[model samples]
Target: MSQLANDSRVQVRKKSKERSKFFWGMVYLAPALILMSVFIFYPVLKTIYYSFYYTNNRGIPVTFAGLDNFINLFTSESFLISMRGTFLYVLYTVPLGVVIALFLAVISSEKIRAIGIFRVIFSSTMGVSVAAGSMMFLFLFHPTIGFLNHIIGLVGISPIHWLTDPKWALISIAATSIWMGIGFNYIILLSGLQNIPEDMYEAAKIDGAGYFTRLFKITIPLVSPTLFFVIIVTVIHSFQSFGQIDILTQGGPAESTNLIVYSIYQNAFIHTKYGLASAQAIILFVIILIITIIQFKVGEKKVHYQ
Candidate 1:
């Protein structure tokens, strides 16, 4: 009877101690949990709820609209045009951005003198804010007084209206995006390149593999994971491009540069179509989620881990 009582008491104390630790652990996490609830969870839930209803300028749902919001979002010509423009922007930025960044990273990874200077030159754009970068590009691409045009004029090429013309506006924005994005990609890929084993390249060279052969068979496979990450992030960034398009083009000259993100901004803030904007926002989320999922699935197969 005495032994049984002692064992039971010890078990009870152990349980109590565990409960105390768990309570304090939750206490420690309370601040982060609160922040996530307030900023992330609550907003997401509210946006999803508002997506199916009619909301006024104040963002309060005024009427139950059912699937009407989503239906209208799909059928809207402006939405379709924005989606096409976003697709073009992605095409113009992601692949080329990755390739350019990788090439710079590879060149910088060499043991040649003054390579760090070149790396700094390439990565310096990372410090520039989107607003500032867009402004700089806008000035450079200005038709008459711009240095870009001045240089081209020296070669006898006619000056072109960059942002004002529909043909050139989207391409010009894409160029700015690539310029801004390369710095980040280059830094990441350079770190990945530095992490690669030098002996692997030496072995390839000993096997009589030339520069291109070693690059394809050895460097590419080893750096693929980093390359894949850069591609994914660049694609996401390309999709979210807004500041430059807004500052430079304002989605104008026939709405040629109006990306989906800018279109969402127009609907929600500019036009006061809150519910419709929420629906579009949800659709945009779904599109990004789907694309990211596809990238992981396909990219996993190609990426070689060492």
Candidate 2:
């Protein structure tokens, strides 16, 4: 009876300690929880609530909309255009930006003379704000007196309408986004490359492996983790591209560059279709979530951690 009582008391004490630890943990987490509740959770819940209802011009929910908002979004020509444009934009930006950045990373990792100068030059675009970069590219893409047009003109070609033409407008925006993103990508990839041990390369050389062989076998596999991170970030960034689109094209030359986020902005703020905008926002969230899940499931298999 005495031993049983002692064991029971010990169990109680353990439970008490656990409860105390849990209480302190909650205390420590209170600020973050409160901020997340107010900022992230509340907004997300509000957006989801708004998505299923019709809203007045003042942004108050007026009536239950059921699936009407999503139905209209799928059927609407403008929304479809925005969807297509966004996907195309993602496709154009993610691959090319990563490739260019990777190439720059590889070259800049070399121990050549004045490589620091080259590194600075290569990664300089990261310092430019999106709006500023867009404005700079705006001048560059101008048909009348642009540097690009001037170069083409010297080569006996007529000046092409870069921003005005529907065919080239998206491409031009993709180019600008790629350039703006390269500095960040380059830095990340360079850091990844620098993390690789030089001894691995030396061993490969001793084993009669050529430069390309070592690069393919050693450099790329080690860098896969960084490359994966860059790809994910770039995809998300491309999907959410807004500043450059707003500054450069305003989703125009007939809504050719009407990305989903900008489309959401247009519907919500500009047109006062709050419910529709909320629905679009939800769709964007779902799309991103699905893509991220898919990437982790499929891509993480190839990520090698050293």
RMSD in Å for all candidates: 2.1, 1.3
Candidate 2, position 6, lDDT: 100
Worst lDDT 10-window in candidate 1 = 52-61
Look at candidate 1 and tell me the lDDT of residue 258: 86
lDDT of 1 by residue, 1-306 (tens): 999999999999999999999999999999999999999999889889989899877888899999999999779888889889999999998888899999999889989998889999999989999999999998999999988999999999999899999999999999999999989999999999999999998998888999999888988899999999988999888899999998999998799998889988998899988898888889888999999999999898999997
Please state the error at residue 33 of candidate 2 in Å: 1.9
Per-candidate TM-score against the hidden true structure: 0.93, 0.96
Best-fitting candidate, scored by lDDT: 2
What value does the lDDT take at residue 92 in candidate 2?
A: 95
Provide the lDDT at 142 for model 2.
92
lDDT of 2 by residue, 1-306 (tens): 999999999999999999999999999999999999999999999999999999999999999999999999999999999999999999999999999999999989989999999999999999999989999999999999899999999989999999999999999999999999999999999999999999999999999999889888999999999999999999998999999999989999899999999999999999999999999999999999999999999999999987
lDDT of each: 0.92, 0.96
Clashing pairs in 1: none
